[model samples]
Target chain A: MNKYDKCVQYILNNQNHFYRIAYCYVKNEHDAQDVVQNTIIKALENINSLRSIGAIRTWFYRILVNESVNFINRNMKEIPYEQQSIFDTEYTTGFYQPDDELMQLVLSLPNDMRTIIILHVYEQLTLKECAAIARIPQSTAKTRYYAALRQLRTGMEDCNERK
Target chain B: MNENKDINFDKSRDAYNNMAIPSTLDDKVKEAINMSAGKKHTNNRIIITVASAAAAIVVLFIVSVNTSTAFAATLSDIPVIGNIVKVVTGRSFSEKNDNVTINVDIPQINVDSTSAPDTAHVTAEQVNAVIQKTVDDYMQEQQSVIDDYKKSFLETGGTIDEWNQRTIDLAARYEVKYQDDRYLSLYLYMYMSAFAFTQDNYYYNYDFVTGRELTLKDILGDDYINIANQSIIEQITEQVNSDSNAMYWGYHPAGYSGTDPFEDTDKFTTITDDTSFYLNADGNPVICFPKYSIAPGYMGVREFVIKRS
Candidate 1:
């Protein structure tokens, strides 16, 4: 198959990963679907720019990350200070329980740190690959990953103590 | 507690794997793939790039597929049946620097006047002029916004490297929502993003028979407002009741406190005479609400397809 066909097959095979990652960022069904759709269209349109087939994973992930961030930036709104505090405290106290405590903590990290954790830990990408996708230095990606792990540990400890 | 044991990375992985994948995901993916395949690459493309020494104006024009003779020939080859309206990309402007990227595609509408007499009140020239002006004005506004953002980024302690690392994108494109022999509908959207992001959608509907713009009253008759209002309210209530994430401004789930301290008045009550709408493929009127208009921004743009009984 040509590069376009291969890229399409690759996307088809890994669509679930795309949806899950987008959902992690957007936290909603419709927006996640939109992100995935946009990513596919973008990837196919620029398929010729792919330097090597071996770099497809990192390249595709980079586009996906960019699209997700763009979606968030476009939809970002300022909440009232009172409601902001409520949301922050709710994250730490485990009020919104879509999943387990660890996943909740994972979701609550700041955007960059959360992206690092998802790409490195859940997606099983190397820290180097994560850095490439996020356009950060490898050292920065490592720093963010360790920092995220520390936060998760501290959060889990706080939950245990509360229980 | 052991760090590895406490984190329960396996459980988190399981949760990630077990996240509910929308049932329509497969179909959506196929649709997107097919759409990509169907998209035609712009021919006779020209890119005129102007590089500025300082942070000054950089003009780049990408003219694509503007040959009217070829277009006319293609239209003539196809046997004439009824009035035909074709929307094509007339010109495109694209500029990419370290700090910003702007891509805008200006659409031109072509009416096959040879096949059908110009009986409609609105001419193709008028519609095209309106579209061109709207797009031009929006692009200029966004370009200035980006320029100001770049200025402030440098004025602050932000270094060139930091500014280069961050990039703003502005894009405007059009989509033909629905078209038939008698009616045509187009949707145009402009999206601008830097630190703050904004998207605006514009819709145009035309009737070839009357040669005029299509209004809600024209489609639904005199009772257009009532018909649209009833359909939208019913849809909103059903969505809010069925999905926990679906939230409208004036409605909430059962037994839920609908108080929002940000605004005192209920936001959405009924459709107005100027409410935005487009025709669906089935020629049904689909009412549109801009993001943050009726509900939160996360809802994006809400649409309700009005079914005529």
Candidate 2:
């Protein structure tokens, strides 16, 4: 099959993965879906720019991450006083909150470190591939992965002590 | 090393797997693919036509150069047309490892001065020297920051592995914003990302005709400050009204309580002589405020185009 067909198939197979990854950033159902939709459109439109089929997964993830970050940046401006209170309460009531303690700890990490953990541990991408997706150097990704794991270990110990 | 084995991600992985997939996702993917397929064909046709036209131009130019000595002489005489300045990466330095990443691209601006020599004030050599020195100084400052971060990280009971994992990135790059035979506008940005990201931007605007730096006054005349302030306030008010997420200092939304401490003191007032600005393609002055200057950092850079009245 042609590259376009192959790209379509890849997107079809990985749509759920894309949605979950985007959700990690936007923290809402609608915004996550928007990020995924935009990513799909961008990927399809720039498919010819994809130099090699072997690198499609990282290439697609790079677009998804950028779209997710851009969506967050655009919507990060100030809310009106009343609306800001409601926005705060929505988080307190746990909208899109992860159920598991480990997942919560993973999500609590800084944006860069959390992205590395999710891509490496959850998505099972190699540190190299994660670096490519996040557009960081390989060594940086490896370091971030370890640091995330260290944070998680510390978090788990604290949870155990509290229990 | 054994941390990976100690924590079981099975539950989190299960939660990820169990997350509900949107019901409309399949339809969305199929629709996008179909749309792309249609666009690809039209794009390919346009590319072909443009390529053929370019090819024709190349053939005509080659034939003229080979057959006509006068045409060749004219081409040699006029190396570049108008006030076009060429910017090239003069030097690049990159070092990447587990600890840090540094990538700096020093730009060299070459001005093609085919215009009248009498109108020139600042020579191209002076401009190039100033830019080179500014970039060199910025690189040194950033290098010191990285070194300080490394020192602090190591001193704070951080392991070598952890230190290595938190690789800092330092970069310096330049972009040409607007250019013409009369005026050239560009900026050099220095970025360092360690525990957090910080960027510094330096803007340079030169008027080749006057041979002096271009300023808001030069573009907007004697009443430059008032003109810029009025234009900026109107744009900000319009932006805040249109977008729910758009916010600026001093301007309150409908439900705002007028209680923000920064409302009175840190708000954007009139533009000073030192306000950052660059010319747009249409020659309008675009006043700029860096992140956290007028609005929150998330707003990135706030820019307002001051139309000539």
Candidate 3:
């Protein structure tokens, strides 16, 4: 009926999988939903800003990543080092489908290295897409992605040897 | 290694699809969009400019589920450093840093009264009780925030009496001069809390003398409240600022946003007439005038705006 009506239907229909994908990054469902709400709100407000269909998910995701970073930054002031097991306590829910051991290993990597793994392997965005989404040069993304994979492999191997 | 059991990209994709985003968000989204329709289209409203409002899809799980526990632990272990570290660095002080020495000092805010309290026998709590009572009364309306603050205060090994004691201790740090009949420190506290002659009703006074606290009622009572309301009505004349929108006569029940604290006190004899000035300029007060009519604990200057340069 109207611009908002059409967009609303589109979002409602396609929301399920995207939300779970958001969950994989943010860990908390509420935060994921908050990120998504901000995302669609951005999309609606700047509808005219969009020029193509292919750009939709990445553009939406870029907004989510930015918001998520801000959320973490705002909350970082409240976190202490002693509660490192905080996430471990929360992971009791069977909702997580990521390779737990591998995911933990990947998270252990420095943030830059972890960002490369999350963008390329987990999100399944291509090299070009990853670079564009991360706002890094293509070569930089390529280098980081390879380094992240090597680190993940090394971590998994170390865990296996310990076992 | 079982190739299929190795939770590959394809299996992850299936699970991702199975987990649904909350469907209840539609109404909220619609409401936000509709309300923002005019503002966002023209870019007049302050849009989500800071990247904070946007999504940075990599949701790190650092907010650890035991957030409240950590917060609770912080209160008991590290008092000043806990607030300071969180304040300075945009990060919470880790529990490991709980080793920082915590001085169990009373949280005394400074209060510069006109002079040191002359009554040698009276304690700080007696002076602060006037302000604290009004705050306790105001919190009757702010029930929710009050409960939270009170709970936190109790949790921090703080008793209700301590807040007043601290306030008085803070005020004592200042010199409370007695001018005509009123205490200057107490008067300044009341005025500041009342929003500097214009706003009153809430216990929002921050003691500029020593960062102590005071309440509006501690300084202004019944007659003054009515006078302030009259003054506000005269300024806005017939129109008043309502909860939602500004409306003319017969719009709302409680006329005006409570009371206008600056209403001329020529007709009122409660405060301005009796209370002696102790702080800055010397003269008969016009606001809380009538030397005998003023109540104890209630104090303010009479209309002195006309006398000063």
Candidate 4:
């Protein structure tokens, strides 16, 4: 088989890893599928720039986050949290269901804040890695993480009060 | 799931593995890759083709057709051509028939497209269609003229078919030019062909302005180089003489070369009225119009043509 066909096999082998990264951001089965497809397309476009297959996970995740944001930008109109039904149902079927109030609070933060939280809580990358992925200073990444957690805490408090 | 300060990275990794990927993720990715590659290839080809085609290409501009009124400030109440033409055709321009002085830009402009007998997007396949249509129009317009020309040629004890053969033989040029004046003034330079460059003529006297077509014999004539240029000369002269005011009264010669006396010289006298001079193409002195005397009413068309004669 040719090199590209072999690369396709390698991609299939590591798809579960790819899916985890995609699912972390999109939070829906269908949108995760779309994100995976777009990441593959981006990989092939910059395959020459893919330093190693080892880095494919990191590279594909970066593409995923970027494409997910772009997709949301186009589809997002108003921040009516009532429209997040599909997002909620998608993870309910998964192994772990996240805190709904916490999810809403995190999502309500600005994109940069949400991205930082997802990278921190879900991806669990180091602060240095997050800074590199986001192209921001390490201190800035720390600030965003703290700010997002503070907002989530406030959101949890408000929900408890309402209940 | 973590009780300790350091959550279990290995367990978390394992949990991630348990999480299912979207169905057909592999196939979807392949399809997207192929599609993106295909799109990239096509876009690159289009840019390369356009860039190559743009080199020194003299395009007959097809100006913008959105000539209807739009919002813009102009200081003039006179309603100049700009107000009439919102966007000019990027190809051909008409001074009188088209009142809109539009800035034209035609990326696909060619002399062949301009010389189309029919006013359609002329392509290679459509060449035959244009040829047939032009032939039909030629027959319609010329049957009577041909019969007359033949009748006169035959009256002197000659066969008409030989003359008919000459007229039929005009297919080589795809256009027919004449100084026909069934009515007074108003000339036409009609280019009727799905073929190569034919002579464009001048009938400066008529509002139905046209360019004449010549036989291959007329174009190549006895002097091989000039048959092509003769028709071009006739067109330049026609434009010089044509204007709205002198639409009918202007003058254009019916023929060229030493064979046709009026076309041989730049002097406009009945015997020697050659209004053209010779010049080299690098802005070297060629044909310049001497301030010659023309009838007071007929000065609009007296053009100064500079060319490598």
Candidate 5:
């Protein structure tokens, strides 16, 4: 099969995880669908540009990250500081159905930390791979991952205190 | 402490993986692939190149197609600062000899990856390609509309010179209002003055993690439509009654005989999806209705800022 066909097969097999990664950014069903669809289109078009077949996973994810960033930057707007805590409300109000308290802590992270943690811990990617997707240095990715851990620890402590 | 941290990490990892991926997504992907394959003409078509400067130091682009064109002037091999990424602003401007003008600016990503360098450039190139394609498609459609107008003008007995004398211009620019590791909001404003003055506004809000363009319903949840509609209606009524300049079509002086201000609420309710809104500097959603929708055409556009506590 051609590169496009190969890319399609890869996407089809890994679509569930792809959708989850997308869902983490968009937090909605339809928009996640749009992102995944658009990312696939983008990935197929640029498949020829890939330098190595071994790096396809990172390359595909880098596209996904870029698309997600573009989508958010394209749609960025202002919310009042008071209303900015909507993500918290989204989780607590049943808008975001986190499986448990740990999931809620994962969601509570600011976008940057949350992304790094998800990539390292959840996606099981190495710091090098996370850095590639994040378009940051490996050192920075390492820092962010550890920082996210600390934040989650603090969050868990606060939750337990409240109980 | 490290062991506890490791356990927490494992727990979070499992939680992350366990979240359900919609079963319909694979079907959607297959359908999208098929659909894209069907559209041969526009698929991966390099449409237009908006701008390219031959300067060695600064390379500026407003693109149509051709990824190679964007890289004409690349950033220095030496990465700038610690995490310095160059933001390549893609812009396209077309002014037909007849005074019909179209200007478009799209932000393109260019990163200098001093570390993990191989794929960063690749990702940047891909992003530039995708964004350029989107802008090109939008401009192509806009150009088609202008072409049709000129054709119809000739058929309707309007001389070429007369249409030329009309001096119609269209300008659209995309603004990156907010950017961070995970979120991006872009606002597009297009104004066209062909027959009468008209302007359109679009907001593309995205969550980078989810890779989705957010909408009002997504941000505000299910009850957003009713809540936002009521809030906007009340705000409009207050403004119309108190502020002399604020006037909806219902409150026009020429035919002020009898029209309830709430007469437009039914129409307002119709704005359930595809509602045009932008976030203010304070990050509040400000809903913008097109010209003549809620007010007189001359008033241009009407906007209501939704303040949520």
Candidate 6:
């Protein structure tokens, strides 16, 4: 198959990956779906720019992340933690039950640090890929990741003590 | 980390990991793909035709749009055109009661997709935070100044009424002097009195593809500092000697007698990596020097336009 066919097939098969990444930013199913759809269209339109098949995942992730950020910046206001719902339990089930307190703490972080945590801890990308996607230094990415984890740990301790 | 902490973190990650993709999404993407097959061809045609007319039309459109009340908010929303849109929009937090009056004009940077994908994703919050902090800091400093003046007035036997009558006016205005697909130059003007007026210029250039901020070294190689220094000194000398009325705060035996600031070839050693610069339309770097730095205050801010070989 040609590269276009391959890209389409890859996108089709990995719909969950795209939706989840988009959902992290929009925090809603419908908006996330719209973001994913826009990303797919943009990706397909600019598919010729994808230089190497090996770099397609990072390239695709870059587009997905950019689309997600753009969507959030355009549509969402600064919603306080009290107003933000950590999990939409209606859509997700089984072993994917979100830790509400931890998720809330994660969402409360500045966008840059939050993105690092999402890319590192949730998306399971390598440090190098996360840095490249974020357009930041590898050292900066590592620093933010550790800082986020530390913040999460402190948050967890507070929750446990309160309980 | 302990097992419990790991469990909680893992669960949070898994929550997003199992994001439910809508059953209809595949069909939608397929539809979009098929739709774009025709639209992409038409888009290319439009781009080709519009490319020439863009320069004239873009300026006209941006100037009109900048006057709109919601321009700042909407500018951040424009995506994928590769141009920088700037509009001065902010609520007047300026206070004018008794002691002093402060006027501030906050500016916002708008990124279209064509400029760089990285910057296009920059949120209104990120850019606004910078402007807000700058304005806030200036306000705080002025507040202290007013307080100090109030204390001194009362100490010198001036009445509260008399102190109240004394007023100092301070204003700050931000201007978007230059912008294109590659570079953006913002000038912030702070006015107190004629001698107290100051202008600061900020230049931002990004890699067209990555949208990452570029520095002088990135464009000018390892010896960028030396090269920039040499170019600026040569430009200054030419301007001071050749120009009739122009003068630098440097020595010329034929004219003004003072220590030659550029005599030491290490003239630009003080220019740090973070020195402000902006590119002109022809892509030449203009080194922006603050007022009273390289020349007398009468000369205003000095700019050295470097013509790279």
TM-score of the second chain for every model? 0.71, 0.68, 0.21, 0.20, 0.56, 0.57
Better of 1 and 2 by TM-score: 1
Instruction: Please give the lDDT score at residue A50 for candidate 4.
Output: 54
Ranking by TM-score: 1, 2, 5, 6, 3, 4
Cα lDDT of model 4 by residue, A4-100, tens digit: 3334555656665666666656666677777777777676666645555566555656776788777766555554554466445643456444345
Query: Ten residues in a row with the worst lDDT in model 6 chain A?
Result: A86-95
B1-309 in candidate 5: lDDT tens per residue? 363444456655676778877666755675455444334213212221211111111122212112333232232232332244445566666666557766667676556566425444764566566556545555566568778988998999989877776666677677776655544566665556555333445455544333334567765667877778888878767775675444454442332333333245323444556466766666667787754455433234578887754
Q: What is the TM-score of chain A in candidate 6?
A: 0.81
The lDDT for every candidate, in the order shown, is 0.71, 0.70, 0.40, 0.42, 0.61, 0.60
Off by over 4 Å in 2: A1-163, B1-85, B112-122
- Report the lDDT of model 5 for residue B227: 70
Per-residue lDDT for A17-45 in model 5, tens only? 77778777767777788898898878765
Measured over the true interface residues after superposition, the C-alpha RMSD of each candidate is: 10.7, 12.5, 15.2, 20.2, 14.8, 18.1
Retained true contacts (fraction), each candidate: 0.55, 0.45, 0.17, 0.33, 0.48, 0.39
- Model 2 chain B is weakest, by summed lDDT over 10 consecutive residues, at B115-124
Local accuracy of candidate 1 as per-residue lDDT tens digits, B198-277 = 66677777655444457899889899889888888899889979975566665766766334422334357788866778
> Would you give me the overall lDDT of model 1?
0.71
Error of 5 at A15 (Å): 0.4
| TM-score of predicted structure 3 | 0.36
lDDT of 4 by residue, B69-108 (tens): 1111111222322222111122332231121111212112
lDDT of 3 by residue, A13-78 (tens): 556544654565566667767766677677766654444545766666666566666665555556
